[model samples]
Target: MAGVRAGFSTDLGGRLNVEPEVRAVVDATATVFTDLGATVDDACIDLLDAAEVFFTQRAYDFAAWYGPSLHARPESFRDFVAWNIEVGLGLTVDDLLSKDAARVRLAVAVDDFFTDHDALVTATSQVLPFDASWDYPRSINGVPQEDYLDWMRAATLISSTGCPAVSVPAGFARPAGVPDAPELPVGIQIIGAPGRDVEVLRVAHAVEAATGHGRRHPDL
Candidate 1:
């Protein structure tokens, strides 16, 4: 992601509406994990407390390594420095010790979660518009009209866990408010334990076979 940001930074940084969508997607996918952790096959779910920390730290490290060449939003970049550097560096000796303890617990939780469940299934994206025309030819500092970040929620969440996940076409549905909008594709995300990429892919194949959604094509 940082690499992609760097590539498009000069041309698209200020022009692209990227943060809101990404945040929305992450929040929506977090709910799926939280709910699944609570219920579903009596499985024990692992919730990482520092998931955002992992994400932001990676972003911050990328920024530090690459310098200001990659910028998402000015405000966002400031917050990254403030949270991961300024505030993080201010942590007391005791606080640092506690953080280490928390990470140990987090590791155990993650291990337990994978042990309990073979795979996880959820929406690929919470929201995406069929009308591509609305998103193209963006202007500088243009705010996204409506949030579509939920579209990558599953991917981001799974990424934090260092687990392998795949998204398969589930089916299609018409946009909720668009008049005469065509049906848009929906995806099902399948996630597996770390190093279980094969299992994830096999389940995704089974899902694709069962749904037969791949056979369909857009009206275009």
Candidate 2:
């Protein structure tokens, strides 16, 4: 990791409501990079339109992959899956075109960011791991999440950038005011420019070695 220039962003410029614990993990990961002889700074690519791009493209994909099955046996799929297929089926040509344009802008912005930095770091998730019975966290930091995808904006927004990103265990977060509360795992996302998968992995590897968080397993 020596001499590698890395940039870290905890909240995607405050576009996402990241939990304080999650943000702290990413911030700590930035320190790990600096200690590894890499230059770390606060930086984030413009992802304001990333959610739109990702959801639009995903809806299109869902329609292509499941529209036939949905039409044949709607009862076989869950409500959210059926909803996604319906959304895809209802997309207008203009909707796709506009999102495509936005996607292009995001790609360009990510490429530009990488020209100045080797890797981008972010919180892997906006909130801690939730109960298995829940579909997804209904809220993050007291902010209501509108749908299944809302809780996952952190990763989905990055996906729209078409960059290679890897998530590595950063540390653990224990709930506040609960002395005996179990420690929840937190992750740091390491992202690189297009075709820079190896660099991202190298950064992830360095982080794993530095923190040793990956070696710790939860008590089941």
Candidate 3:
């Protein structure tokens, strides 16, 4: 997200022609945030806000961060479609997580970094009160905060710079011995950075906000 731009994946994807320009604004906003000392998630929210602010002023439904991704459209863009909501501005940690998986709560960040054999993430999230998971390319050696940042930065550099990140609740994987109902679900994510997190959440929120999803999750 640090160096990502909205149009980075244009060759691979495009907005519904109607909103292409707005998508570009989001890309520019990501660049602006990088220049402004904001992290990916921080910059993303603002960029999203700017888009909603624009349309909201127009009275076009500020649901940019809150819209639906599922809709009927011209068939030309049909093949590219999937769960696309995430349209307007608003709040909700769940929605944010639905939009970006990189937004971690940092429960075991410090402890994970200092443990033996580079097991930082494993050590930390494993012991935390809630259920958690990690995606270290190497073995999970939960690193300290500094080390965790180092890990993220290094990973960003090594991987494709434009990887979109989202961490939506994947539902809980309860420990067998525990007596409590699942505390809260962990997240599932699809990494991308065209700043389309809004589209992602719009549809996701509509569904998650619906009656029974965790019971029957579908691919987005």
Candidate 4:
């Protein structure tokens, strides 16, 4: 991965195509957050709206191959591409313009955040729950649920800024509800503005040294 320039993937095909159980988990988590009065602020909602367009432009259709190639791709890949395309086409002219505007705002936000910093770091996962045997495109009831877009919500949101991000070991998390579950290793993602890959790596190294998480191994 070390080269003059490095590349990263975002929301593989723009939709994770995860099973319905994942969605149910997400919905249940949201309910808990809502009931606990941990509602998301309006600013965060706006950021999510902006992130959709930013990620689509910079990563999903970065090469402008979404149109013709979507038709020729395998059934698995084509569905997500077609879905993204359908969403894009459904937007009004004003909506399209707003998305473009959001892209510019997102770029500026990234620059402003990293203006005086080496990098920005955050927990890799907001929740500590896991299912080791969970399968992708999983079924719920009987039909498969293909839209698991929230899986990379944070990372892809940052990708809209064209910044570089690296995920390094942060430590383990105790399972919230499952008493028998093992302590799961989590990651700390370091994000830096565009062309600041070196700075991102440095920050990751510093976190590793401070936490010494990399030195620890999980029991099998």
The TM-score ranking, best first, is: 2, 4, 1, 3
List TM-score per model, in order.
0.57, 0.95, 0.24, 0.60
Residue runs of model 4 more than 4 Å from their true location after superposition: 1-49, 58-82, 88-95, 132-146
Candidate 3 residue 163 Cα shift, in angstroms, is 4.8
Quote the RMSD, in angstroms, for model 3: 21.2
Local accuracy of candidate 2 as per-residue lDDT tens digits, 1-220: 9989987788887878898877887777777888899998878888878988999999999999999999999999998889999999999999999998998888888888888899888889988888899888888888899878998888999999989999999988876566798989999888898899998998889889888889976754
Best by TM-score: 2
lDDT of 4 by residue, 1-220 (tens): 1111111211222333322323333223222223333322211212434555754564335234554555556464645556766555455667667778888776666555455444454434433435656433243334454454444455666666667888776556455455677766666455666897886776566546655668876765
Error of 1 at 186 (Å): 0.9
Worst 10 residues of 2 by lDDT: 172-181
Error of 1 at 205 (Å): 0.7
lDDT of each: 0.48, 0.87, 0.29, 0.49
Candidate 1 local Cα displacement, residue 101, angstroms = 5.8
Q: Give lDDT tens digits, candidate 1, residues 47-109.
A: 454445344444445546544433434464544344444434344556656555655665676
Clashing pairs in 4: 19-138
lDDT for each residue of candidate 3 in 1-220, tens digit (9 for 90 to 100):
2222222221112111212222232233333323533233321111222222222222223235223333333333322122122223344556454433322212132123222211000000212132235422221233343322222321222122233344333333433355564433333232333344564454334323442335653432
Highest lDDT scorer: 2
lDDT of 2 at 90: 99
